[model samples]
Target chain A: MHLRTPLPPRPRPARTTRRPLKHRARVLLLALCTIGATILVSAPSAQAYAPVEIVHTEQVQVGPYHLTVGFSKWPLRAMQSLDFTFAPDGGLTGKSGILSMTGPGMQGGMHMGGPLSRHPRKRDVWGLDVRSLSTAGQWSFTFTINGPHGQGTGTLDNITILAQPGPPLALSWTLCTLPVIGLIAFLVVAWRRHRPSRHLTVVGI
Target chain B: MDSVHAPTLTGPGQPSPPDHPPRPQPAGAAGAYTVLAGTLMSLVGVSWDVQWHVDVGPDTFFTLSHLMLYCGSAIAGIASLVMVLRATFAGRVGRPADPTVGGSPVRVFGGTFTAPLGYLVAGTGAALFLLYGLMDLWWHSLYGFDAVLNSPPHVALFISISLTMVGSVIVFAAARAQRWGRIGLVVSIPVLITFTPITTNAFNGVSPAIDPQLAGTVLFAVCFILMGGITLRRRGVALSIAAVLGVMQLFLWWFSPWAAKAYAAHVGLPLRDNLRHMPPQLPSGIPMFMLAAALVIEALLRLGRRRGWSGRWLPQLTGAVGGVVLSFSMLVQTSMLRGGAGAGPMGPSTTSATTVLTDAILGLAFGALAGYLAARFAVLLHLNAPATDQEGR
Candidate 1:
């Protein structure tokens, strides 16, 4: 018969009186640093002062109307969320407008049209709020304005939208699904590893 | 189980060991306990996601909240996978299936793999959840930026996770012989109860005196309380689950708001104008009458046993009775807390006599439905097949 041996009890640590002020100061400093870092990293990618900075403006003259089409971000990139503003010269009193967009992939120029509404945050001009174009190619914005000055139509054509920012969608999906494949392989290995002795007539059932 | 042969008698004066040995816990085991934890994390994440939508507007594909939600689902999936594969391997070797995996072993892949009913169901739910999650991203890409609760893909996701929670409940119900199993059952019942509540979170905002949304979710919650009694076949199982549920409810009450504000501040986003003065839209609440309803169920269940009642109707009746009691409980709580009568979070109360009556009536209808469904589910979980169905006994 084998003799049983009991495990030795773990020794308790000697109590040390820590400097509360010093410890608290370190913790407070760490917290402040973390807060400051988070604020810096997550600041919204918009100018805080003068929220809409119109980097590029295309002047479209349709009959007597002179319309200024403004883009918040220039060299427009597809899938890049930004603002689009349409400001008719001499302010917007008693003037109503509709904006329609036609892009390269759209067959026969079937326009995506809607009444131009003022941006919720920026009320001075008719605008699209945090919008993104899906395709990276030539696109056009058509504007229709109706007022005492009579109705007029204008188009800002050959507006190039660059390729979407970041890696390809397909590539992202492939990377995401890699773990799924790995999980399947792991399951197969696990099954084989724990499997009991296989003998007799039932072989590999 | 084949691993569990006849009790091993070590030597003279030594006691006979248990029929099955305790398995090691990996990521809190491929077991019921892990499912409980996983479901809770997922619900917390859901609460956070809802709050994020309310306060800060649209989110990208990856948020800290979304990650937490995905992590929860992944844990459940991994746990179910491990259990199923191990069980399948053992069955293929002509070994006895684990006793914890019920008598009616669900064979798959042309009878080659032995799948435990709970794990199979849970694994399938997890797979569906992941698929639906991917679909959610596509949905966002196709139709940009809107925060509606009952979106098609989001609903599909909720249903899948609910399936996982149901499977977790079955896991414990099947393993009632162990102490851990009993405790796990207690914990799991509460987790499952909250599963539907997260779907009704939108109602928590903007002043609805007696939220009609509560009726549907209360039905989901109260039925599970009855399930704790019916499936466990014990006197006080419902009460135990209700007690555990209170702890969860209290934690959520505190954690939901704190997490929402903390994350919003971290992201440097301002709260929307509507939500500037509101409380957190919690995914679930205490369900005010649960404790009382549980005691009622315990009494009725004990009485059923004493009378030697047999067959299916008892659970349904008990659930119906509990449902009514809970509806009234909600009525009392609302009256005391709202209608501009008290300092409740429901905001500038609109509770009228007519509204209260309407809520109670609707509550009654929902309660009956909840009871009827809970009865059938409890029975399904409790089903035991004859020994002839299994091999190498």
Candidate 2:
């Protein structure tokens, strides 16, 4: 009945300790690190050149200062949204600047002029959003900077504005042809169906 | 009730047994109403679609508004196809064509399929619309979205849709001649609606240039005056049509923004940044002067009748008068409500006098042209004569 005393009660296995708080903290830290890495990687890279599609950039000496001005889009279209940026050779800190954009065919004082600020993402670059080209022709943008070092002015000129592109040719032609063909078929069929009957009636009489 | 009338030969020779001629079957109440519904749906759908583009920016081809437009085309196409099939089968079975079936069947494409001329034309338009819808999707993918109104694909689509409108006009003309007066009135609303998009530049309230706006307004006023005036001979009929159209335009002016907002919310689509916080300005104003212009035209028609004047140049005359009135009224209303200038598309405060004078002159010329064309259209569609006087003519 004892059955060998039930083989002397099997030794209890060691229980693993649960580190809930510590485990969670480690996981949370890992997640934060991953997210930080992702954000850092995705952020725009810093470069000496302007970030937008630059038509051209040049170094210009303006009243004892050196500066670079850039246009964002090439062959600008009427009412095209773009950006313009100015970078002083020294730096943007302790500097304030204004941009005045004027173009041909634009009314007097119709120029887009605004103060430049450090781009939020690119701290070294001083820029402003130019909402529209507004007119088509040659545009001249002038930038004036007043810094603790000195005040200076520079111009980016001969920026050509082109007419906005129309719909693509192949697609336009294809779409236009469909209705014309259908209309012709309809008219021709209608005429053919009616013509013989009218002729027969005239002959029978 | 359906009845077949034997063809009457008016020749003086002895009467002989004639071959079985295709019977004339005017589109009955159901067909008339179907076309009317299709047209209204098209108008609503097109207006909504345009607003969706303005408010929501780019969207896929299968948006709700597009579905609505396609549904309209489908309804018209199905109704037309049904009529064609019915007539074809009826004729094959040697039975009298049902007057409720559709209009008389004309053999199309070497007798491959027999269908009424209106239905055939409408069906062709529907097919073209389908083709263009696909082409538009492709075109957008290639060319990017159009910020302006007159893309080539858009123009093609408009032309196709206009063909459907023309078919509806012809169908309603036939129906009205058979005493479907209410249907004619109902159909005219859609006709006017369809015409509105073609003239969006005139009334869209966005452009600051006065010349385009003036031309657009003149064209719209002249075309509509001619359309209503030439089709309807009864006193007040043209005016009533114009009034109804104006009311619809007003409703759309109010409804487009609401519908756009609601649709964006329902689909969880974020509106473009520019439109998000801005209060919606009404897209355009109804041509309120259309009613006044219509009244003047009616008065002229009455005077013409009293004086026994021929109606040959009546449409042109009506158009000229309507154009002047509409342009003047628009100028006054815009100037008063929005300040003397710069407030609307009419332009800056400096050129009000020049704009008004120039617009007035252009409107007169365009109105006359539109009147002439509308009169010709009416004659072509057999809508020139009164419904009662249309028999045998």
Candidate 3:
């Protein structure tokens, strides 16, 4: 048998006085920094956006301007974000345009409109980055352009919106069966190896 | 000599002193409850996430629903870890080791760590889920957006979550055999909720055209019948549980859409334009049928017990009957509601009589097979066994 050995006592901790003012100042600084960082991070992404796929593109003439308009994705689903670009033949040197959109789900005749800017990388391209479509149905987008010559409006109507895609066939089937397979395998192994040995004594039987 | 004379018995008829005081009723297993809560949270999160996807399209990995899902996983993982640690190191902390607190620990990883089997299983599942979450993020990045539900990463995640649910069931089953058995029934709420998604996958709201309603009905009927047979044992209790589950489903059918709408509004997320005009997806009529099926099974079991009928074929037989009942009920309900409440642009429009009949026949056959399989599996896993003080001893 081994004899027990005693250990030395632990040292007491030193006490310190609280500094309220310093703590308050530090907390205030931290809060401000956090808010500033959040805004800085979120601002750029909010302004410039692009769609996942480019579905449709067409050219139309309005007054002195010849414009090409593109819809980011086809058979659009509700709440999908996509880019709407208008490229003019002349250029967007001293010119600007407004893209006004109206759809089925809009509340009480309200239309969403935003200013289009010249593309940062491309010449003669001006576009409005639309965040999302609120509903699935026919939608109309009217682009009103103002240039040195005059103002002209071009409308793209009857754009069809479809429902979102359903579950992928192969993946869904495999996922549904995977757990069943696991259950079967576990049961099979347990039955072969452990069942007889613990048949009667195991609880809850 | 004086001591011996003084040590006389009170009387021959008097009862002797007890050897030891009766053990205090075992404490409610906190870990079991934690796991249950986590499971429920995960189910809700998944449902909301799906709605969000339908309404708002593809989003980043850091969405609110994803947070809720991961939070559930984290809770289960942490709770399991704590329980394992407490069980393994209780003696080191100058306390008498209590096996009942977290059940018994199994030596694993070449005897490196001693942990309760349920906890170990759950922890492994949690780890797998986290890994799959990362995989899902990578997959989304590579493939753009998976508009489909059954992506590879999602399947992995589902498998992991199922393992966690099974582990939770095993843990509570052990508790149910002891004085703390009542908690098992409580835990069943979350278990049922978690399993509901899996059993109903064949007839998910997204696939209205598929006439696999019969397959879904058979699957759940067999599952619920087995659950009733193994867990409740009493006819009235089983019936009550089935009724409660049905009521709960009805409530969820209404609550889910409302909750999704409320959440979307709160988060400033957009809703599908047509959804505002369209009715919500109809609740699968399985729960009501399950109640009827449970009653039938209870009656049969009682009859069999009185008649000294062989117990071997009972589950298979019950399953077959339950399947038939469920299929017929679903067919009738679908036929009645076909165009009125059942018709959604997203749902299948056709409900022909021929299809219903064929599905019913198939359901009956599958149900019997499922019933037999469930019985064998339950026995192998000791799922229906009574709780005992010592587990592997």
Winning candidate number (lDDT): 1
Model 2 chain A lDDT-worst window of ten: A196-205
Residues B1-393 of candidate 1: C-alpha lDDT, one tens digit per residue? 111221221112233334444343333234666666777788888777877765565365567787788778777876776677667666545565653553235655444345676776676677667766766665555444345555456766776777677667767766655566667778888877766765554345436555645675568777887766655666578898888888877777677777767886886655443333455565334575589888887887778767866434555666677777787776665555453655665545666788667766756667667666665555444332111112111
CAPRI accuracy category, model 2: incorrect
Superposed on all Cα atoms, the candidates' RMSDs to the truth, in angstroms, are 15.3, 20.2, 14.3
* Candidate numbers, best DockQ first, in rank order: 3, 2, 1
Which portions of model 1 show Cα errors greater than 4 Å? A1-205, B1-30, B200-212, B274-277, B283-286, B307-313, B333-344, B384-393
Off by over 4 Å in 2: A1-205, B1-27, B94-105, B178-181, B197-213, B271-286, B341-351, B383-393
Reference-based lDDT, residue A137, model 3: 87
| Residue lDDT tens for model 3, A60-140 | 776677888766665466654455567877777767777788988677877986667543223346653334565678888
- The weakest ten consecutive residues by lDDT in model 2 chain B span B1-10
Q: Rank the candidates by lDDT, best first.
A: 1, 2, 3
What TM-score, over all chains together, does every model reach?
A: 0.60, 0.64, 0.63
lDDT of 2 by residue, A84-140 (tens): 557787787777777788997568677776677554224467654434565678888
Give the 10-residue window scoring lowest on summed lDDT in candidate 3 chain B.
Answer: B1-10
Chain A only TM-scores, each candidate in turn: 0.64, 0.49, 0.50
